[model samples]
Target: MCGIVGAVSQKDIVPILIEGLKRLEYRGYDSCGVAVHQDGQLRRARSTSRVAELQDLAAQDGVAAGTGIAHTRWATHGAPAVHNAHPHFSHGPGVDAPQGPGRVALVHNGIIENHDELRAELKAHGYVFLSQTDTEVIAHLVDLLYQGDLLDAVQQAVARLKGAYAIAVFHRDEPHRVIGAREGSPLVLGVGRDEHAGAFFLASDAMALAGVTDQIVYLEEGDVVDLQLGRYWITARGEVTGRFQSVVREVRTVHAHSGAAELGPYRHYMQKEIFEQPVAIANTLDAVTGISPELFGDGAYRVFKDIDNVLILACGTSYYAGSTAKYWLESIAKIPTSVEIASEYRYRDSVPNPRTLVVTISQSGETADTLAALKHARSLGMLHTMTVCNVSTSAMVRECALSFITRAGAEIGVASTKAFTTQLVGLFLLTLALAQTRGHLTEEQEAEHLKALRHLPVAVQAVLALEPQVIAWSEEFARKENALFLGRGLHYPIALEGALKLKEISYIHAEAYPAGELKHGPLALVTAQMPVVTVAPNDALLEKLKSNMQEVRARGGELFVFADGDTRIESEPGLHVIRMPEHYGALSPILHVVPLQLLAYHTACARGTDVDKPRNLAKSVTVE
Candidate 1:
């Protein structure tokens, strides 16, 4: 995934572009660049380093302009290098001419699937290629298609293209003008406020335009936008006609969490997010005074009654959240549930049921694979769709029939903490809603669940108070290269999430299995060097999980367990126990996961890894 930010303004926009890129740093990037129309010439600066380095380079090069496009590229078609960085230039048929500011400069996000064919076609027209990026082909294509109007050129260029992409382009001659388009990938238009009024911006995420603008228009699929000083217009590809038509997309006032992006009292965003879970969960549940199906949407009750089973589509951490929900949905709601990895679900042939409710989970809700899977499900006649997402204006929320917006705010950390926990809270509420609709929940049970949900903030705060204990355990875990996590029943997915968190941030190799399956295979990997992390909640399977812990101990494996205070799991030789404040029954996963997140965070800190921006990962998977 990559980050794109463009500005059309009366003031010098170099700083705004750099600041927007900085806000998007959490989206993960290897190379960054910015191009601007300056003094009747296209001036640009690029670096194969962080945005800060690119900012310095821009300052040193004195690259400043009121209209510009910038990008933080995560390598796709080419290796991470200065030549491969974005803001690609098209010199325009000057194959042998001296290097000069010629025509167009463009930045793109997502892959151009037919770039090779397009590149070959452009080469025949004497448009020399400079970089090994698909984005470069787009720039040269726009240059060749420029008949005068930059908007027309971009439209023609995109017409010849294939694959998912969001692009922003500005021509050398078209001053104070930027043209942006979105096919399958995400792009938004930010209308500036106060003193910055009359300025318009384009960004991949609303977070990129935070503080600069609160009014945002989420560009839909196959939409093109043209932005000038104080005006903008949009055109959308018609569904049946396959032709672009003028359309109006709703603009919503969103308060992007610019303050949340700041790491004030914490060392990293991951650490800050881990500590923000209590408030995040509380805010997510703030709208609910009592359990009701309407919590999802206006007609959720009818949809819930019509659905016979639940099909959850998601990827990565969100997928694991869905896996955890499968237990709650089936056991508590008496509904058959299936969790499918979004990338895999669309390719396989399977029987589809119209009565099945398709629920998609995503933190950013712009995840390309999940969005594609949602569309695939809709194509199969499963039109009853819902999304449990953080961003209210995300594509997932807009496409789904119903949505429950989480209050996790802006999760900057690549390894999710608050987002995952908040999603579980939302899924839990969904389970209760379905249970009530199915007549499996009584009024007393509903009140009980509601009370527990209300107290989640306090319960999570207790778990967070154990951060010191987790930090102590992190010292031992930092030295470990391999780990094994074990749990049973409802807690198994939490163990998997723990293992995922450990591997994601600490760069440690970790695996998780149900406690009952330990002797089946995973026990073979247990040794004195292997550290076993167990989620030992005081549930029905506690005794069985204790037996699994003993199997590890007998193999000389060191054990680190997060257990309930009443579980009576004491600390001993080769066995380290951290007692939880209370046994939270059904909500134990939310509490148990907090300490595991802390362990991963502190272990990454101990090993001096990039806890916020893990290598080879991005906060939002906007590309497949």
Candidate 2:
């Protein structure tokens, strides 16, 4: 979970790298540094706060540079100190090389899974390393592998390396060119006319390159780019490959930008994102007409149709989304579905085999654990691998045999608001596609489902209007340190995600349980001091959730209920009820999840936490 950017230009590139790093700091802010080659000398600086401070220093009047690489790091190997920051350098072969003129520096994203082995190999070659970071291993490895050609050295080093990585390296000899490679993490190339007028930039994401220059080149998973003085292109080794070009869209329309001035005037990104639910849902519905039953390919029907069992793999919030999706995949598709956390899926002795349809969910395309699981499943010879992801051209999408794109737009909030709901929308649509293919749902049923799906946006709007209510509810939870969320059937997973969101941002010890599981264990945690947030959508499980709420009430625990308008479920003495608009079938979960998200967001805000950048968490986990 780090950010890397590189630029090759015929003119000074200090300003460009500095601005790019500021935009990219959201990816990682623990530590940052830059390496720029100027006047036949390579200069570097690193710091721990934000990228702007040192970057501002790097762009001094006389600090003219033609080529440079920058990185904002999220620590994995060492602590988040200046020493562990990216643009890590070594004179000759180690970090403490005595500040010499001739030196090499490297910036990296993703993990070097076999760095220990590589480090031992480098040490055997008499390459003394300084830093404790796994990244230092790569820097030395590149030096050992560097014979004459810089591009070839990077290529050979990457070939010998194991696991996921996006790397940018700079050397004194090859000061005019910036070399970059991507395996699991994202790397996009920004193109310009020439170095004088235009330059090519390599960044972790499209947003980092926004407004600088939009002419973009997207790198394929195994492809590497060589950005020389005047031109750049991707290559597998020496063979050039075609680049994936995309248009740059404005960050937001002028009206949406101005209207969302305070981000809906919410206190934090979490709260703002909560209020964005109605628009997010509306956009999802507006963009999707209906998935052509054959959206994947010709054999899609054969793989998806008449499935006997299903397996779902994902990490974090996406895993919770999968948990809720299991209910619909089983009930609607009439298929037995088992949900597995991606990190643990392959490690366990399990059999998904050839019959099961494995679906993976991820907000960003590059979740390290989830990607590892995807690769392991591929090796197991699982033929049908599908994904539901927000990123269009992520590693996960490229690897999956079939995929659905979630149109949630950019989710800057690390705690994830729209990503969860958009995933639900995609999964619900997938269920409909599978049911129709399996002959479980008729034309009338499909039509009714679509009609209900169309109304989801309106239902979400109903929930959005209750923000003042949620804001008021936030006060009651200000002093709370623990909470329990309960739901049954379709919403069981929603409860889990709700609890996860609250704990993620608020640092509250929250646990979620299927209302059915309460009698078994979780009920023991309920007390007058603990708040119980229950998703009580009016459905087959509504009565069951109602009974569970009574169980919580019996223990004198506080209750916060979100139910449909007609359920007539009123708030009990220590309980509070927030009513939702009516929607039937699979659509309710998508609507029901909106309020729970808001509750967690408001609670976190009331408790005064860094809602955007939560403690000890990364927006995307690029290393397992």
| Per-residue C-alpha lDDT of model 2 across residues 262-306, encoded as one tens digit per residue | 344555666676667767767776756765556544567778764
Best by TM-score: 1
Please give each candidate's TM-score. 0.98, 0.90
RMSD to native for every prediction?
1.4, 4.4
Clashing pairs in 1: none
Candidate 2 yields a Cα-based lDDT of 0.77
> How much is the lDDT of residue 267 in candidate 2?
59
In order, the Cα lDDT scores of the candidates are 0.92, 0.77
List where candidate 2 sits over 4 angstroms from the true fold: 59-64, 93-96, 99-102, 121-130, 194-198, 237-267, 295-299
